[model samples]
Target: MGIKALISKPFAAFTISKMNKWKYNAVAAQEKVLQNLINTAANTQFGKDHQFSKIKSHQDFIQHVPINDYEDIKPYVEKVVKGEADILWPGKPLYFAKTSGTTSGVKYIPISKESMPEHIKAARNALLCYIYETGKTDFLDGKLIFLQGSPVMDKKAGISFGRLSGIVANHVPKYLQKNRLPSYDVNCIDDWETKVDAIVEETLNEDMRLISGIPPWCQMYFDRLLAKTGKQKIKDIFPNFKLFVYGGVNYEPYRAKLEESLGFKIDSIETYPASEGFIAFQDSQKEKSLLLLADAGIFYEFIPTDEFFNEKPSRLNLGEIELGKNYAIVMSTNAGLWAYSLGDTIKFVSKNPYKLLVTGRIKHYISAFGEHVIGEEVEHALLTVAKQENVEITEFTVAPQVNPQKGEMPYHEWFIEFVNPPKNLKEFAVKVDEALQQKNIYYKDLISGKVLQPLIIRSLKAASFINLMRTEGKLGGQNKVPRLANDRILADKLEQYIIEK
Candidate 1:
């Protein structure tokens, strides 16, 4: 279905006679969109040739796709590598968004011109929904500091990646475009280092009213900004920075450090940003995450977290899903990714389809040793331990690594940067272990010597962690220190610094 039809379809499916009455209409509309996708995909050559053509019903679609991971899509990506078009979409692609695939190699996902409006509208709906929930529409009128992806692609007619933010930046409304804090659009520039440097120079003097971007990149920007001005507080640089909008990864680990670095507790909002599109945002003033734009061209599927890694993950479309359980998000966008599993996991906070929270990345989950520990579980467990001990953290990452000692099970090791380091580090470690044990039965079993050993909490000077990432060519700019490293490569590297010392 076209964008205009997609918008109106929901209303037509159910009676959205008034604004308050629109909720039922949304649910109805979502089903219609899915039906349309099933029909359209059956008719299209790409869809027909692909497995999606066999999807006689939504249930069949879920049963057929097999919940693809990045490895499964590698062959398609190889096609993309050869400059092939019409693989995912019907028409010639506008460009690709070059985002690093967390589990494997860097991915260059195609974006089509037709899909661009869906992206734009998704962003608009995300913003409008936030405003609708909090009555904060006036905030959009302020000077905005967008910490967007730097444009590395030279503008041309050919399909390319690394131009997502550039495309979005150039495509926003002209009136709002005129009001941007810095005239420079980082996403449009070819050289990242030069673009970032220019952005740093431009914002040095301007009153940065609102800052928005991935938290890691924003953190780097703020860190450099603070260092340059010789100021300890965030207010010192951008006195007018009323709102701090961050998305992408979980910001819990960095929250204490960010608050410490900034010098004030600014209101923060977490958004779910993807290479495909902006999926959701925390719309409530109380800071709760919401789901995808229900009325947009995006259609969603939720696979139960328990079955997420299974070969045939049993899926739940909008009507079948329930609240409070984690689900692997499968999505179909106007971008032509039918039943595309984007490796994101979320928990429903409310019964409303739009009310949801980003719990963790699907790849970040650790169940290797039967301990299905997720990012939220770890974050909460750490918080519980900290609260009990009255200690505060700057930043942290948790990894499950094999214990070097003979006959020991895999254990979770934490690299923590502390604001208030406990005098007795061993006691602090015990407290954290106790908290995790209480949180998860599996963790408790592991701690009691039935399975794994007690988790080891290693404290590192905050600067050391920062320097480590910097030395790896991953420090500063948009790169974030990975929170939950699944394998030995990152875990072993961290172990050398955190364990040996």
Candidate 2:
């Protein structure tokens, strides 16, 4: 056996065994995880405040701890930042994953040594599981290029701070580091544009076997590689490339374009890892759904999307979740997060293995004029329209046009940056409107009652999204265009950047 296969053989076996055990008894596995999480941190301040010692069951834990967002947890995190020990997790956190804040500047999430292993181990198992199921071990022999964020970490109040991906990239195992591309020196370049240029120069002649990144940014890297090599597709440059692993955004819209760039079909794996913890990953090649890591370091709770905005919402554990319902995910993790709102929404597709699809974000939707449209609905409508029109969309965003002149009704306006523009823009808009009306009853009712007008579509020039991200200081690496907005806050700004036909 090759060195790659030899190194991964034991891990692949372990992952498969764990997958089988969890598949048969996901509920039991989740309950055990919850009990372990409680017992692990029962002495921490947060655990004591919630009376974790007295808590005997999931119900007791929920009854004591309320669901919290970043704002609610800031005070405790602040204490940790000031060198306080055992504020949330036992002792001090090893590092802090700094995530982009919605209103605030940046939110520092704790990542304890206790939880770091969970993140690294789960990601490793995700790949190993894919290898076991597909018998695809050649990737282990070649280089794996992970287009991650900058690994240059900053010390703040005795803790390291940087992007979660960057931190994880720095921690690639010693054995596998030989197959990983982009030297550590190049990864430390903080400027995104400069980093991409350096990565292109470094990996141009390498024998790459696997590529992992968010789709849009990975597309950027692939474009650069093609340009440098004068190649038509990525496969032409890296013939042995076998897998494309991605996460942080839905891959549906980018799938067609990415395949076109690759020149052939390749297997893919999707993972759902947040700054707080690694949540779920695609285990079975037969299904697109991601299997929840029930036995991992995180304990999960779900609140129905419709009830989440209420003052008090009912929470359900893994055993209580029903398929097909949208639920806002709440998580308690080894990283010192307790009943924390991860701001993500998901819909279960399978129960035996507890597989799910990420539906949307909790605060990301358009409900102006009572036409409640979510990110998933908008993406589905756009995909339908694109497929029907034989077009490819690179990036897009939707916002409600609530204010109208006299004799005008409210409507949802779409700003789309297309790789392949449709032959007829008017027809494309009509198809999109029809799709949305079919998918969302609220939107359809508004249109039927004349409370809303037909959806508006505006085409943006190529690379407009890159410029938008540049202007917002989030040009690359895990930053994605917000798919839906309640109002035209972003739409109006984007209008200035829109290309006139």
Candidate 3:
């Protein structure tokens, strides 16, 4: 074993042992984190404005601070961007993580000195926990490729500004610097396609063992790899490849295709990292749930998704959350965010250690006709049916078809780019519709009541979603296509990309 492989054994043990102190005492750790954050930032202007010094309990914290979306806290973020000291955190942030969304244009999220370590440590400890669980550390000796954004940062009011991944690139530990692949210059390329091509060149012959990125971007890199080397399987190019780490989007839709392209089933770790915080990670190889980072400088509140739009939603702290119920996560962090709504939804599967599965985006749902359909339900329905039919989906999205052609009833329109499309498309669509009805009662009622017809599947051209993402200027690095939309904006746009058989 290489020195890293040998050293990782004790390191992993020490790290996971330290982690257990908080994991077993998760709720208490959360309470302490909230108090620490509040106490630490009490001298800041935001703290004073919100009566942080006076707050003694979670309820008091909620009463004092309203749950804020990015829009609600835009003023504070603006001030922070202007180099205002103690505007949000105790002092000016070390960096601004610049993120752009479809609806919310550009957002500058603060990365305070205190919060930065939390992000870094949580990521590092994820690997440690994995090593402890599986006793696999030899991959650390081989080149580790992080399919990420440009490491080049920009200046905003003298504060370093860049994508979260880029900011993280600056923090890659010196030890792993030698093992990291895709030269810095290649990573700096602006165009994603150009970057992937360059990456293929740089890491083609390297002893790459671990690959990490969002699923779509990783697929892009794999495609580029095969094109450049003419390798049938990724494992053929780098037989050492054993681990695939992914975040940002659900991997179920792309899993079969990725494994097929790679020519083998590989180990994967799902991470829940947002610009706001490093929330959770898969600690066990056996379970799909990601272990929540309770002591990672972020205090979490689970507001039931059903009550999210109410005047004052019930913001339940860690102890109050129940398993199997969907909740919109609200976080108060050392970054100085007070009761910030993350806009992502999650369901708890385990309680003591607080392991969870990210269901979908809170607002990214299909509720056009009162039959609220979520990403989890849709994915479960489609993937379940597709598996039984031996169909492989490359990419897909759903939109409510509020209006249909003359003499036809409106229905849910599924636009799918299939890797292995079913032989009988109509029968497959019926199976998917039935699966969806089994998952959601509202959707079943609408279908049975004749208010809506069974879903219609539109087989899209190969790389349709890719072309759409590229055209929208969001081709890579944590950008994801929403699985379903309530409005026709995305769905309507997808109409032109459709290919009729």
Instruction: Please name the candidate that would achieve the greatest lDDT relative to the true structure.
Output: 3
Point out the higher-scoring one by TM-score: 1 or 3. Answer: 3
Local accuracy by lDDT, each model:
0.67, 0.89, 0.91
TM-score between model 1 and native: 0.86
Sort the candidates on TM-score, descending order.
Answer: 3, 2, 1
Instruction: Assess the local accuracy of residue 322 in candidate 1 as a C-alpha lDDT between 0 and 100.
Output: 82
Per-residue CA lDDT of model 2 for 287-404, tens digit only, reads: 8899898877788999999999899998999999999999999999888999999999999999887899999998899998867788999999999879877899999999988886
Residue by residue across 1-501, what tens digits does model 3's lDDT show? 999999998999999889999999999999899899889988898999998899888889988999988888889898888878998898789888998855668998899898898888988888888899999998998999999988899998899999999899889899999999788888888798888888888999999999999998899889889988888988899899989998999999999999988999999999989989999999999999999999889999999998999998899999999999999999888888889999999999998788999999998898888898999999999999999989999988999889887878989999999997899899999999999999999999999999999999999888988888889888887788899888888878788877783
- TM per candidate comes to 0.86, 0.97, 0.99
1 or 2, greater by lDDT? 2
Q: Which 10 consecutive residues of model 2 have the lowest summed lDDT?
A: 1-10
- Stretches off by above 4 angstroms in model 3 are none
* Alpha-carbon runs more than 4 Å astray in model 1: 1-24, 50-56, 63-65, 73-85, 102-104, 130-141, 154-157, 185-197, 387-390, 406-410, 476-478
Who is ahead in TM-score, 1 or 2? 2
For every candidate in turn, the CA RMSD to the true structure comes to 5.4, 1.4, 1.0
